[model samples]
Target: MTVFVLVSGLFTGPHVWQETAARLTAAGCEVRAVPLGGLGRIDGLDGLDGLDGLDGLDGKVSDPGAVTDLESHISDVVAVIDSVGGARGEEIVLVGHDYGIHPVLGAADRRARSVARIVYLDSGMPQDGVPALAAVPDQLLREQVMLLAAEAGKGAAAELPPPSREEWRLWGSVAGVPDEALDRLTALAEPQPLGTLLQPLRLTGAVTSVPFAGVLCTGSGSSIALVQARVDFGEPAFQALADPRVTFFELSTGHWPMLSSPAELVRTLLDAAAGRGHRLTPANAAGPPAHLRPFPLDVPEAPVERIGRVDLHLPSGDRPRPAVVLVHGGPVPAEARPTPREWPILTGYARYAAGRGMVGVTLDHRLHDVTDYGRAAADVVDAVERVRADPRVDADRIALWFFSGSGPLTASWLAAPPSWLRCLAANYPIMAPLPAWGRLGSAFHPAEAIAHAGDLPVVLVRAGLEVAEIAATVEEFLDAAKEHGANIEVVDVPDGHHTFETVDPTDATREAVRRAVRTVLGHLTA
Candidate 1:
């Protein structure tokens, strides 16, 4: 007679809850898996079901905002509760993961009379009026997020960025959402509503009166590094639930548990449904998480500041090309050069650019000393000035190609962007300072660069999975340029992230990346 209503976390739909639901059902419990609005395949363009489903809804979709906002999600939870009515609602175990706690609790409050118990799978409890983002503990990411919000300023309500075509692809593989349903999920995904994130939650007494339990994943659920650990550890949430009213299970898994450990995960859910408090002790727990994706990091170079020199990695055919100042991330010196041939990626990008007859330059900026992204940006601007003053640079042919933070810094420096060297190519650019993700984008909110857009052409590239909830930042930057009547082109990279990479990226994926860069270059020449 009891039904179980399950809610998934951010960026996920009801489909992910299927395995657990099926397991619970086999144990004789009725189940209702509810999909959240922005992530599910049924609605919007950024969902997992397919892109076609959300295509017609593009331009009509709303933002996803931050995870703490409960008002919006209340409706998502209530819809399923309403459908189940009185009889089944009485026996429901309302469960949620990660950000799913908000809606699941909100729904139980609204439908208090019909609900049974609430379970959080390593998800933080959504305190009334408290924000979900406030719980994140990563210092660098938090710093970057605050900077983005401050930069966004009054534009907070504007559209967020959409995940690049590549990002969605990567997320599916990493999250175990399956490639077949990727396009639809991406199309259904929406820019989170900023106000919802900022708004305080005031739960009606009815919600807390319901029974509840929680399982917290102590590791990566709190930071990006932890999320990355999933590549090898799988979902860690299931390994830590130890309570009886709510069983706590800890697995050495990644954030996306269902994708990596569905079988053990299913058994746990079923045990909970059967009042068994299922937990994996020493013998039966899932194995360590495994991440097959490869992530690349740029080696630190010497610092450059004021009017001094820096090292930047721009692939323009020949290295040490005569007469070019370079810009780089962190502090790297000219002597700290990394052999291009050694890094297959740098090699590929370099070969492509040089084959197209582009000159190369590299530079570095002061970031280690500065405690904030804004100061770091100033360093980038100074480096560019140095490049301009140098007689070696063919000012007419200067093209700025960068990813992440450098994109906004370079774009901001242009005043009357010449059609040639004035061209801008950026991927996963830190164009907007996102409040929700804290300091993640603080170093280079594209809005800061808007002053110079009138002088040049700008293009933006976004990684699907890496941007995650902060996808809207890209849109705000593009909107500023279009507002100034500047020409702009936007490309969505499939299976892409902060860096230019795919999950086990194949030659085809590499070719796709190459074509994208070349297209941007060709457009500038045109």
Candidate 2:
């Protein structure tokens, strides 16, 4: 059988996969590293972003946000897929490494009908909606991207990493990279649109059922934990591996396996492309909750009132409603205005609590302003107490529905849950934000939440098709929930992804949200 696997080529060129491809060939398999986008000898007659003289520009201009270039690069990937084994076979395997993951995964999402296998090599978060630049971690290069995002509202993105001496050194100076390629890389290393980076890589169609795999180099364990002075993801390397389509395997080597250990890397690629199933387990497992069923809450829409110059929605109804508060994600903050833009959760979920018949209070809490988890948690606890104090609400029936930044807030509450507050319904909550570099899941920590959840009804929703960072967080949190005996329900939704699902709304993802909310709250009678 002719098996194909697409391999990610980080900042380097497609030639980077030559060694691995060679090895695969020796094993009677045809391997070709899909030279992506503007890389290699590819000619862009029209040029990216209307730039001229790009007819011979290589794919060196790596920017996540530039949708035009991403689309162009996508065209290239689509071409490669179409070209795969014209006469041989249609077994195509796709691998993405570093920035290459952007093109690799993006292409796969569009070309899943033709692709046989997909691989992410030392990749970053691959999501839908947000651009590649926004999704990429800051450590990939030296830049302040969040600041950029703030300037342009939600859709603004970072530009391509400018070709620099340091970057050149990182690639060319590396042991396996050749010195002669420096000039070529510099010549072709044009600045790409930063928009592509922030956009989430969406592949919901046949991709969900495709054989996706991640070739994680073992060295990442040492570096992810110790090198960055961050033991966050590295501590649970095995667990961090994501990609619903991926069948991850630890190829013991540096981040660039093709360069460091091509033969073994090729073997691993073959194993993955062959559709051979491997017994995979996450490294870190977040504990379980004490309760095993959803607690019924009397949820009612809490109206908005001026609280500290900000409108706050608290649970209000005729009966003493079992209350649940909405703790939302990290939003951009400004010193001049408390709530710069109305929190996303308000329209998405909080406003509808009244219709659901639960005493639900949606608070526009300070996300970026609060420095520490303790203070953040203390605020949530304060809100819980305030709602419980309300004469119209059932004090003992309070629960939490946290998302993004709320993960840490809920975790702190879980650490020392208030007697009156119920358990948590953590929806993609935050945990260890320090090391995650703003990527979802990895940044969302949940240990303290599990430890603190004292037998309250809990439901955890994580996108099963999320990248390593996001999926890892969800798995650990769910595991922790199960361990703690919390009445926990879990829904891993990858089959449902939408375009621009992050900032804006999409029908598929919106339905998924409804399912999560209804699933978690429906079980409990109001």
Candidate closest to the true structure, highest lDDT: 2
- Candidate 1 C-alpha lDDT tens digits along 1-526: 6677777765556655545555655666667766555544443323333222221223322254444245766676787777777652356677787667777777787888777777776565566667654444335533544665566686554223445546532222234435544454455455543333455556787875665554433222233232233222222332233223444455434445565566666665555555654332321232421122332322222222223444333333332322222233321122322321123343344344544544344444544311344565675556656655545444445566665544445544554454435567666665543322234343345665576666466666666665442355676766777777766776666666555542426554565566666665675455
CA error at residue 520 for candidate 2, angstroms: 40
How far is 452's C-alpha from truth in model 2 (Å)? 32
Model 1: weakest 10-residue lDDT segment is 331-340
Per-residue lDDT of 155 in model 2? 54
Instruction: State each model's CA lDDT, in order.
Output: 0.50, 0.52
Quote the lDDT for 304 in model 2.
Answer: 58
The alpha-carbon deviation from the true structure for residue 333 of candidate 1, after best TM-score superposition, in angstroms, is: 41
Give lDDT: candidate 2, residue 186. Answer: 54
Query: RMSD of candidate 1 to the true fold?
Result: 14.9
User: How does candidate 2 score on lDDT?
Assistant: 0.52
